[model samples]
Target chain A: MRIGLIGTGNVATILGRKITAAGHEVVQVYGRSAIHAQQLAAELQAAYTTDMDHLDPHADLYIIAVADAAIASVAASLPLQDKLVVHTAGSVSKEVLKVASTRYGIFYPLQSLRKEMEQLPDIPLLIDANTPDDLALLRDLALSLSTQVGVASDEQRLKLHVAAVMVSNFTNHLYTLAERYCQAEGADFSLLHPLIVQVAERLQYMSPQDAQTGPAIRYDTPTIEKHMALLEQHGEMKELYAWFTKSIQKQAASGEL
Target chain B: MRIGLIGTGNVATILGRKITAAGHEVVQVYGRSAIHAQQLAAELQAAYTTDMDHLDPHADLYIIAVADAAIASVAASLPLQDKLVVHTAGSVSKEVLKVASTRYGIFYPLQSLRKEMEQLPDIPLLIDANTPDDLALLRDLALSLSTQVGVASDEQRLKLHVAAVMVSNFTNHLYTLAERYCQAEGADFSLLHPLIVQVAERLQYMSPQDAQTGPAIRYDTPTIEKHMALLEQHGEMKELYAWFTKSIQKQAASGEL
Candidate 1:
């Protein structure tokens, strides 16, 4: 299948490599930067273009792996001639592509991508197209690369984005906090990793509510009070402890904590 | 070894059962309530006691797995009589046991323990003691159950506790937040999980700053504006977006983002 690859960022570069490796031919590569487009296209032996108008729209499919904000405008500017266009953004609405053509959809891969990542999984592809034919085309395209494919609505994708924040962004903050707190105490943060890994794994079998441990959940008032004393310097952490304790107590009352 | 376990709470119950399974006898079970004590003692085939006088200093060792507030008083009151005594708390200073006995330490199992979670891997155990022999005894005891064991300072243990909060407690709260937001939008939260796991695995290889994705990290102003607009109702989320963006920007600037 011939592919019109959009953008030359990490996701675009990674997917470009993956798609080409899967025996699909990338006919054109577009990027906001001319040099980046040329660099990526050169690697894939494809045409490179900086201008949106230069996009051929002649390939079997057009993949938009650009920044989410640029998607709608880029789609609007592209002379697709009613070709199928897909944008890969978790929180962006599929309707963003509708302005360009009704034969558009979302082709989101549920993974963090980067230029240096050596091993990329045949990612779980979440596809949603406007027409049944387009859906079949996207699904068939996704099936060639990934075994896991599902149709997700905008609402479902947004919900997933929120969950992603919890486990990913917010969870990473915990590691940072641990590192900071350890540094403050002149301790090695690495010592706590085993504990971190175990607590994380426990969540596999148990719900977060049931797997919860520590001073907050137990209502260990003295220790809670002690931690609060130490956290006085970090107002955010102090507020977090207070709010979390109250939240857990409320959840406990509801048979959730 | 004959063991006297104080506080028949969930931790005590779990430890009692596991120790019993290890073929060691829990000679005495102490609880704040006589009924709870008797019930736990019956389960472990041990004698039950509510009074401190029955805390036989004759037992090979005493494990105090009680609440943080009660720990100081309970240990103070127990007829430790220089008997080996250790408290199973991550936050509390092991010095709390010094008043009760000359031979004491801490035996903190570095994993979240739920009531029904009967089996656990050899999660790294953190041990500390007031004397060499006590440390050896605790070390041998921990080694008997798990190969992963180490000694950490009280300050380090507290940092671990704080990290535990960020990962387990705070992460769980984020889940709750996502659920609330998704529910408000009629979104399916499950779709976000693979992304969450991806971010998590990414963190194992890269620092949080490097692993950071999404509009906030990408500096995609339009997408950020859209997400900000989406978060109009949640004032707290708005603040989170702004603060986290600022923080990530600084880290990204310094860390080659």
Candidate 2:
């Protein structure tokens, strides 16, 4: 399967490399920067194009792996019609690609990507298409890069994106705040490393609700009040601490967790 | 070392088992219930006593592994003096043990413990002592059970407890909420597993601030608003989603992350 990739960022670079490594041909790479396109295309042994019109008209799939905001304009400017085109944004609607081709879909990979990563972890692909044939094509392409693939509607994808934010971005922010708090107290933050890893590993064998621990889940008011008092100087974290504490308590009370 | 353990809960049971397995003699086990203490003592091949006056008077260290609320009462009731005593509560001050013995300290393990765990992971023991001799004794005992051990002040331990709450308890709650949201939307919650594991794995190689990715970190207002609108029906999660989003934006703006 020949593929044309439209972007030169982390997702585009990582996905393009993985697709090529999986024995698919990344036939053309397009980016706003000619040099970046050339560099990535050179690595993938694919042709390079800075202009949208110069994208290979013959590739089997055109993947617009650009920024979410640029997807619509990139789709509109593309020269393809009645051909498979997909955008990789998790939050973007599949209809954004409709202006580029009659057969459009989403080939969203639900994992964070970084250029410095030595190797990619398992990426779950969430695919959606306008037609059965296109859906099949996207599924096959996703399976080539990942064993985990599923069809998702725009609503499902948006919810998944929100979940991703909660687990990844928001979770990481908490870690960041924790590290800062440790530094403020002149405590060794590294002591928390094994604890953090253990918590994550615990999820493999148990539901998150069952995995929950600490003062909030137990509703130990004295401990919670003590922590609140300690956080009085930490304005950002204090409010967040209270809000999360209340949410956990509410979940416990509702028995939905 | 002849060790006397107090309490029969998860922490006491697990820690007692590990200490005995590490070649220390669990001289006696004491709990509120005679049967419970006997059961734990039998597992450790040690003596059992429920009466506070009957605690092993000659044990090298008396570890009070009871609930945080019971620590003070248990400490006051103990007949030991000028012998090393320690409590395993993270938030409690070491002074709680002063009534039991002048030689008192803390033996707080940083990881969440459960009775079902077959073997403990790397438990980072945070030790605090009233004297250098007692500190060395506590450190040696900690090292016997874990490779990771550090001395932490009461203030530092409280801060660490706060950090642990943010990273472990709060993070797990977020996962719980995400799974619930997935269920409500009829989306496959299992699809988020790989992403969750990937986010955790990334932290092993980089700092959390560097690891943050998603609309929250990027401050994608349109995506944030869309997510907020999707979460209108989920009152608890809606507020949490908004708070986390604002926190991420603030972190990014302050450049502290």
Candidate 3:
């Protein structure tokens, strides 16, 4: 399928290259920034355009990979008739693409993407459309890029997005805080890397609740008090530590596992 | 070196197998439960003992791998003299072992251990001792079991323990909550596995602060509000979402990165 990419940010660049590599022809690249559009288009071997009106109308599918806020305006500005249009934002609704074309859908890649990554990670694509035929077409297109693809309604997608934030964004925030704590205490942060990897790895084989082990779950008050004493100097981390400890204990007590 | 393991929990079972695999002699296994002591001793092909007075005094090192609360009692009961005694509790000080033997230290493995796991994950051993000679001896023993080993003071070890809880225990708790949310919302929790793995894998190449990307960091109020509305039914999750969002924004505003 001939694809027209409608953004040049990290998601756009990574998806553009991936789509091109998947044997789809990325016929045009569009971006508000001229230099980024030109550079990405050159890398993708596609035509470049800064104006939304110049999007290649001849392409079989147009993917709007712009920011979530800009998706509506970009969809409104695209000069396409009945061509299939999709946006890659997780939170945004698929209905926003209806302004760009008669047939619209979502092609959300549910993974963090960076343009500089040498190897592409496995991206689970969540897709939805206004019609069954359009959904089928989008699924076919999605399968070309990822093996892990699923059809989700707007409500389900939003829920998945919330879960994604908890697992990825919030989890990484804890890591950031822990690294900061390690730095402040003059301990080597890398010492915890193996533990980090093991915890994530164990989730594949066992439930996270089963994999949980620490003073928090055991309710080891002595250890907890010691840690609390150590964290006294760090205000934000101390608060978060207390919050997470309480949360874990509550969950354990509720027998939610 | 000859080793005696004084516990029959997950940590003791895994460490006993690992130390035996590392070509050291596990001379004896001791526990309050005779059945558990026998089972672990049978697995390691070592002698089993339920009586504290029956511990192998000839062993080079006596590793107390019991629970945190029982470490002091176990150490006080151990019948050893002038032998290296170490407890495997992260937050416990090496001084607790002073009651067990003239030589005392800590041999804390800074990773979660599960006896049922088919493959032994890399365990980073944190060792500390009362003397430089004992420290060197413990380091050699730790190096035999794991490639990643370090010497940490009691305060430093406790700090690392806190960080480990954040990265492993708390992170897994987040995953547990996310999986529960997915189940409640009728979304496949396994779909987020790739994202979880990638987020952890990227930590090796970049700092979590540098790798952060999400609505919280972007301070995208629209998405945040949408998520908050969806989380209304989940009281605990909603509160956590609000706290983490505020925390991430505060971190970003502080320009600590």
Candidate 4:
């Protein structure tokens, strides 16, 4: 498929390269920033465009890989009529692209992507479309790039997005707080790296509840008190630590484990 | 060096096997439960004893791997006089073992251990001692089992323990909540597995703050509100989402990132 790549952010850059590698020709790279558009276009050996009105209508599919707030505006500006158009935003609805083209869908890659990553990480693609043919086309395009592909409605995709935030964003935030705490205490944060890896690795074989361990689940009040006392200097981290500890204890008390 | 393994829980079982694999003799396994002690002893090819007074006196090092609350009591029951004794509890001080033996130290493996794990994960061992010679001896024993060894004071080890709970236990709990959310939505929880792995893998190369990406960091109010609405039925998760979102926004506002 000939693709018109929209935006030149992390998602666009990474997915543009992936689409090109998957044997789809990215005919044009579009960005508000001329430098980024030109750079990505040069990398893909494609045309570059900063004007939304000048998006290559010759391309079979147009992918809007911009921020959630910009997806609808970008779709509204696109000049395509019958060409299949899609936005890569997880929270945005597929109907946002209806104004852009009759044949519209979604090609949301459910992963934390960064263009600076040396190698492509495994991305699970969640797709949706207004029509069966468009859905199949997006599915085929997505399957070419990722083995884990699913057809999800706007609601389902949003739910998964919430879950993704918990697992990726919120979990990483916990790490950030821990790193800060370690730095303050003059302890090496890297020492906990193995434990982090092992905990995540265990999820492949066991459920997270089964994989859960530490003072929280054990309800070791002494250890918990000690930890709370140590975090007195970090107000936000202290509150978060208390919140998470209570949540764990609540789960345990409910006999869910 | 001959070792006396105390407690037959996950830590004791794993460390016992690793010690034997590293060519140290596990002369005896002691536990309050005879069945557990006998089972672990059989696996390590060591003698089993339910009575703490009957523990092997010839063992060079006695490792107390038990619950944090039980460590002090267990140490008090041990018969060792001048032999080097260490309690593997991270929060427990080296002084806890002073009653059990003249030579006391800490040999805390800073990793989440489970007996059912098919392979031994890389465990960063944190060692501490009351005397210089005993510290050297503990360090040698720790080095045999793990390449990452450090001499940490009691306070430092406790701080690391707090951080370990954040990265491993609290992170896993986030996964647990996400899994629950996915289940409620009738979405496949495993779909987020790659995302979880990628977020953690990136931590090896980048700090968590640098790697953070989501509606929270972006302060994307519309998306955050949508997520909060979706999580309306999940009171605990809804509260957590709001808390984390605010925390991330606060961090961003502070120009920490």
Best by lDDT: 4
The runs of at least 3 residues in candidate 3 whose Cα sits more than 4 Å from the true structure, single-residue gaps closed, are: none
List TM-score per model, in order: 0.83, 0.95, 0.98, 0.98
lDDT of 2 by residue, A1-257 (tens): 99998999889988987898899999999999989999999999999989876778999998898878888988899889887999999889998887888899999989888766778778899999999988998888899899989899998899888888777777788889998988887877778888777777777788888777788877888889999999998988898889889889988898874
Model 4's A-chain: what TM-score?
0.97
User: B45, model 3: CA deviation in Å?
Assistant: 1.7
Return the candidate ranking by DockQ, descending: 4, 3, 2, 1
lDDT, model 1, position B12? 88
Task: Please provide, for model 4 over A105-143, each residue's C-alpha lDDT reduced to its tens digit, 9 standing for 90 to 100.
Answer: 889999999888888888999999888988988889899
RMSD of each: 4.0, 1.9, 1.3, 1.3
Q: Would you list the C-alpha lDDT of every candidate in the order shown?
A: 0.74, 0.87, 0.89, 0.90
Encode model 3's per-residue lDDT on B1-257: one tens digit a residue: 89989999999999998999999999999999999999999999999899987777789988999999999988888778788899998898888888778899999999988887888889999999999999999999899999999999888888899899889888999999999888888999999999999888888888898888889988789999999999999987998899899888988899663
B1-257: candidate 4 lDDT, tens digit per residue: 89999999999999998999999999999998999999999999999999876877898889999999999998888878898889898887889887888989999999999888989889999999999999998888899999899999999999999899889988999999889888877999999999998888888899988888999988788999899999999988898899889888888788552
**CAPRI rating of model 3:** high
Best by DockQ: 4
